[model samples]
Target: MTGRFGRCRRIAAALLTAVACQSAPPARAATPPDTTARASGVVTWAASADRMGEGTAGQGYRLVVHTSTGGSDLRVRFTNAFGDRPLTLDGVHAGLRARGAALRPGSNRPLTFGGARTVTVPAGAVAWSDPLPGRVPAGIDLVISLHTPDAAGPATGHWMAMQTSYTAQGEHTAEESDANWTRTTGSWWYVDSVTVRPARPASGAVVALGDSLTDGWQSTTDLNRRWPDYLARRLTASGGAVRGVANAGVSGNRILADGAGQAALRRLDRDVLSQPGVRTVFLFEGVNDLKAHSGVTAADLVTGYREIARRAHAAGKCVVAATVGPFKGWPEWDPAGEAVRQEVNRFLRGSPDFDAVTDFDHVLRSPYDPERLLPFFDGGDHIHPNDKGMQAMADAVGLDSLDCAR
Candidate 1:
């Protein structure tokens, strides 16, 4: 009887242990943290890079740019995309612009790559600088000073900056005064884009992919009066989520052919999709294609637009398209080209591929002559808009439409 009681007690204890084990929750599997939630910097200003003239050895460039969104930890990108040999930049500096070729006192700061003072970018490649420990204010003129010690190949830069930048004979990157920088050039060399870390992690940017009109071809020099510039001002004043603006416009660029710069299709990834913190792509091109008379029909242009929209969508970006503006008085204007423009604009307005559409044609066209640009807004060449016209184009854009879900 004692042995039987012992056995029964043992069985009851085993059953209770099993019941307790079953009642307890299973061990939770460890979840990995989401790194994508972290904020990288957003591009505050950008210019598309192309093949400039041959690079000069021991040359220093004081490139001035206008910022659209202000933020901390400012960074800059240098392009060697058109270079045939490795480009070595020995000195690089960033500062606020006090005047022509002059930096604000005590604002000049040094930049590095991998914690080193010098960076070597291979041919057909680009390099980004380490973040500087300061804030860059919105709509401010920022100057980037760089010196290439052994640069002797095809130089990569923006040809029609429409802003005055300075060049010197030797390494004067550390200077804040205009004593060393005496020569002025209407271009930006080496440096392409500037980025900053905004306080809000949700802040995003839009890239204006266009041609000469978008490149500020005829706008007042050093005034930052491009249509995108006007748009940036509006965005800042409105206090909207999309505060950054990158102008990826290359003058004389075409949609299907490589001419002034790589065709819009070829350079789309580098100029638009690859930009950091970009939520939208504002496409305002195709004039060159129509004007060139390369047998490019409206259907062909539409196909190109579809491809661009498709690629941008795949990259999780919203696409906003604009109708081609009037250019009847321009030298390249013809009835056939005008017809093609009309058809393309119609397709852009009704296309479901685009998240939004801005009718720039309606905004710039003359009421008296539908095919011609408005005289008051024409920049004299009839293809590009003056300062007032640029502002009108920006005003025509619905700010709310820029903040679209991708």
Candidate 2:
């Protein structure tokens, strides 16, 4: 049921063996013209910019998502979309919530840089760790925690893949919050994406994109209860088409210009368009632009919607657009935001350019109001859907829309 790696050998031995193999293997000559950069080395996932623990709050913090079992040969990704000077890190460790919701060394490591713990990940770059004895599994969730004891501030927050992250007293709270992270330390700027060479290709991946509702903010951590995670399980069990899905939804992503990190339009070239063998794009995103930017007109949003449709069609990729769900009673939400959402939904329901479509609005709407999120499925944040609501959204997508299924 599990795979294991041979025990760890010091770096010197590894270098000595490589030096000897240089003769036996006959060095793979550099600059070979026939070389191809395959997808194998490229690990793809999504991230968002959120409010990390910052301010006079003394407890400034940020928790990026990472795989629980990707082995010690792995690298950690800390992010900072906006920060001054080269960000720094004190220490880094791989841990898990060992019951009581406490952090434990699920895989305690000698996390180092150039063979040391302290390193500065220059602004806008990702760092990788030297190979160690750690090998990871697919379903495992890891707590890639970053801690800082210095009063120096590099405050930039983002949406973490896990549901929630707890903090202790000082920088050590995150480290000591868990019975195991007693001596924890690490910090940096942008931990955007982590990469690990998977032993084999993933069964399959579905890229789910949308607003906060699709991101699953209030749900429990590492549970993968987001409908996309649930759908991954359902697909594997059915042994059917579209083997698994990767949630590409960012908390406040928009369809047009950059509202949070990159607008859906700019991100599409990366998120939907460039995804590897992405079977289908469960397209949904647009509410934040209408809600957050009061100046954006309904007509402008529709124009952006049509542009998405046109580009996806050109990619020869299958498309499934979900009607924007409800957000009426949100604390700062305005009535104008509601009307813009309706106009965009009307365009999506038309299903003109998309290869397939689903009515996410219809799936979560209360027949009584039709425009508001159904009471039972609302996670109280009129903007995002509850866990159950996420399930409903996934179910409405239906297996029939996927080409691999047919």
Candidate 3:
């Protein structure tokens, strides 16, 4: 079933005009607000956005993302950063995913934009929905359905979700049953960040900025087994100050180059810095830069890391740097790449530029062969970690390191 679904695709339109019209201001008037100027609250769940592909008309998307810290006054944000034309959402609904396309009975609810049921997001912009007065619990599946009557051009979204989402034709936003949703997709479309007013002002969020590993590749599909997912669970269990976790990882992404998605530095402001209640920028990247053999030297990678820390600090956020892990058995592994990894790891461990450091290299590398991942921890590919290793990496992190006052 998974394999067949993987081959399937859903051509969908961007969010546009629909029922209960809530007309937005002219495209020029609508823009992504400065979240920093507003009151702070944790972003309970978020996925970075990218240009996925083209959109289809009359297409509906039901994206499911897992939440970490839960609170009331839940809100969602829709993005059109990669769209060439204004994208409009006609129907938008939120609910708990009971299973497949089904929502928990009575859990489904309609969401409006600025007191209206419709919103038109300008090209390369985003809009946040007005808060819904409901209690959204933690560690539950939040399903968001979107209907786009006139979506076209470049469709902006996260491509490697790792979790399965449902799709259908027309407006299935208000439905609680799975009957209308017939197609399945692994990408999260349009919607990016989901925030909630925290129970306490001290509770903030940590956004993990990395590549496929942080994006949960090799982890079980539909299961929250990403290292960030593990970290989120740990933070919640500890009842710490940084309880919210948002993953800003993109598969095949690099720290300095653009290919699979925008480079980490390029998308930093949109994916991490602008997020509400973000207190820490968890920096765990560079593996791709080294492996790609793109003339990126250890010095070059170090410069990238420093720039990330500098920008994050300017945003009043703490930076936690993670040592690059070993990937000896992977095809990209070579003496030059290994040396580069070592140098970068050394800088991460000793850099005062970072607020804190987590030696993920020491956590995931094999003691006997420091150049390779521990056999049990290797997710068969030698580059990505297994579920157990993900847990170990999370366990190795110092919860206190993330609770920085910024």
Tens-place lDDT digits, model 2, residues 1-406: 1222222222223423433433222111222221112122223344443334442233323343433113223444444435444455544554443433354432333344555555554443334544333454344444555455442444544444554454443444235245443332232223444444444443334567766666767555556667676665566556544553556677677777676657887767644554444567777877778785467777887788778767766766567778877777876577777777888788778856677778888988888987688988887876667778877777777776755332
Cα deviation of 176, candidate 3, in Å: 0.2
Candidate 1: residue 270 Cα off by (Å) = 0.5
Q: Whose lDDT is greatest here?
A: 1
With a 3 Å backbone cut-off (N, CA, C), the pairs that clash in candidate 3 are 12-56, 13-56, 14-151, 15-88, 15-89, 16-88, 16-89, 22-117
Deviating ranges (above 4 Å) for candidate 1: 1-39
Task: Rank candidates by TM-score, best first.
Answer: 3, 1, 2
Superposed by TM-score, candidate 2 places the C-alpha of residue 162 at a distance from the truth, in angstroms, of 6.6
Mind sharing the TM-score for model 2? 0.67
In model 3, state the lDDT of residue 381.
98
Q: Give the TM-score of candidate 3.
A: 0.91
Which ten residues in a row are the worst by lDDT in model 2?
27-36
How far is 147's C-alpha from truth in model 3 (Å)?
0.5
TM-score of each predicted structure versus truth: 0.90, 0.67, 0.91
Q: Give the number of colliding residue pairs in candidate 1.
A: 0
Write down the lDDT that model 2 would get: 0.55
What RMSD, rounded to one decimal, does every model reach?
18.1, 7.9, 7.0
Q: Write the per-residue lDDT of candidate 3 for residues 1-406, one digit (tens) a residue.
A: 8763332211001111121233443322232344213324679898999998998889999999999998877788889999999887867888777789897666666776655667788899888887766566677789999888899999999989999998998888888889999899999999899999888877899999999989999888899999999999999899888999999999889999998899999999999998989989999999999984667898999899999999999989999999999999899888988988998898889989999999999999999999999999999999999899998988999999997766
